[model samples]
Target: WYSTNLHWLDALRHVALNVTSVVTTTGFALGDYSLWGNFSLMLFFYLGFVGGCSGSTAGGIKIFRFQVAYILLKASLNQLIHPRAVIKQKYNGHRLDEDIVRSILTFSFFFAITICVMALLLSLLGVDWMTALTGAAGTVSGVGPGLGEVIGPSGNYATLPDAAKWILAGGMLLGRLEIITVLVLCMPAFWRH
Candidate 1:
């Protein structure tokens, strides 16, 4: 909206790039998108926290989990204020059961734990704290690009060690499967059943 572009193709191209950038969270760009400023970049970073549809390949904490958590959080705060208020968690006109709410909360907790663990792992590998943090975030989010100069947009991950790369690859798999799926298979009980 700042500059006037008469070409319709430019507008379409902009929209396409913007959507794909967040949808995949790979941070690909055809131009100087950094001009969008820190707020926009931060917004895009937050997008990686919001995954696409359940069946889609887009990874991160799926949108439904966020929705469930938001509803529950709202209900909790309302209860705090009203004390005797009977609050209900509803979405799309349907009430959420306890199991679904628990699952969402568990997933969110595990996701955050994974990020922190992975960041610690990277830092132990001699990576700077900033790189380690964003690298963990990107890998756990299943997003290839991260913050800082090394793994950020226009930077290749080749600088990382083989071990770090391998760890990050595992992180990607964990993220894609929502962590619990793969972790469950590692339990000794899986084979007994």
Candidate 2:
């Protein structure tokens, strides 16, 4: 489902010539996104880290889990509103337990916190705010490019110091692996079990 305007044009233009979609672009849409305004850029950056469906190669937290989290969170809030109400949250026509919901919430929290911490570290390395924010998001999401002048599609990471590069690489690996797997591996309890 992650398709493109070019693909849409190619698929539709042959069938309907009346549609007046005209554009001549040299590079990919990723580059086009990098060229968007700050608000649009930030949104894409968010979605980039909160990726496609589960089992897809695309990185970041999958959509279904986020939905489950939202539903559970809302249901929990509703319980406070009406103490005796019985509300059940369902995903994919199946019921989810408290443990599963808690796990998803914890994962999302850590994922966001990790990005912010990485961005702070990047800022300490003399990277500007936009670059740091988008860079952290892109790295953690495995999206490959950040916003702003240096790290955007028009630029490369070659100019960054070895330390910064290593930090970003670690973020990429952690994000791709999912935060829990790496954290669990780091814990002594995981080894004992």
Candidate 3:
């Protein structure tokens, strides 16, 4: 929706750059995209969570997980339609084991839950809703700039409260290490082992 006053090619390039930057967790900005209106703001905010492809250094939920989830859903629906039919799951020409699918789905669930919980904690620290939610998402996804006036592309995190900063720091650690790794480390059983 940012096609006003600029050449269409320039606008397309800018938009593509921003999208690639966010998805790849590169954290570059040509301009304060938060000023591009509510729709673009929200769109960029969510794009942070899509992440890059599997095996890449980029954070957030990887694309393969979503593909596997879609495969699982499709197989499930097909099974429902024909109880006697056997469904074999495969991805990229390789047989998809139940364990791998379960792991991917579990990671996806925890990724979303961690973002929501972090957002709630930020809100409790008196941060505004947009800042809290987008900040949490951006940090956890390793996307540098968040939406909203305080932490948007033009704004820095120095203005945030100490507690909020600490929380976001934790989110960065979790995102970089992958949520499951940190969560496993936090368990008493892991320590005992």
Candidate 4:
């Protein structure tokens, strides 16, 4: 709840801006939303990972991946119930190939793992848990601001230790490039090709 007596329209606009900023990884903020309350903080934090649609420049895991995952889960549940029924996998009426499904799932897995590992490394560097976790998520999603006193909307990354900054920087690159691209580039076999 805001203490300022904002008009309902003004409040709606602010909420929309904050949500768009996080979901699109635009990094713009109208205010320090972390001060809004725990619920708003958590909502914005998670929105960073939802991201914009597929094929967009926005960084987190794209919306289509989640849609595919949901469809796959539903299909699996249906298969379990019907046992012998043939279930087709389709997205937007196009038949879904196994390779596409595999790639999406793999990317999602690596995205999460990368965030966790980075968070752990930040913690080891003496960053507090909230900062470490949200910082990692924010960076990996290519969302500029994190949720916390240190790197929240009102705060910048300038105060963070050099090592932590480097870690977050790496996360930003991986997120922008897409996790699989960087991971593949790291393989020795790829160089031999």
Candidate with the greatest lDDT versus the true structure:
4
Clashing residue pairs, candidate 4? none
lDDT tens per residue, model 3, 76-178? 9999999999899899889899899879878988888989999999999999999999999999999989987899998989999999999999999999899
Off by over 4 Å in 2: 1-30
* lDDT for model 2: 0.70
| TM-score to native of every candidate shown | 0.86, 0.79, 0.93, 0.96
Candidate 4 whole-model C-alpha lDDT, 0 to 1:
0.92
Candidate 4 has a TM-score of 0.96
Clashing pairs in 3: none
lDDT of 3: 0.90
RMSD of each: 2.9, 6.9, 1.6, 1.3
Steric collisions counted per model: 0, 0, 0, 0
lDDT value, residue 3 of candidate 4 = 48
lDDT tens readout by residue for model 2, 31-79 = 3445435665566566565566777666768777778878877998999
**Which wins on TM-score, candidate 3 or candidate 4?**
4
Q: Which consecutive 10 residues in model 4 have the weakest lDDT in total? A: 1-10
Q: Please name the candidate that would achieve the greatest TM-score relative to the true structure.
A: 4
Worst 10 residues of 2 by lDDT: 18-27
Residues 18-87 of candidate 4 have per-residue lDDT tens digits of: 9999999999999778777888988898899999998999989989999999999999999999999999
TM-score of 2: 0.79
For model 3, what is the error of residue 182's alpha carbon versus the real structure, in angstroms, after optimal superposition?
A: 1.0
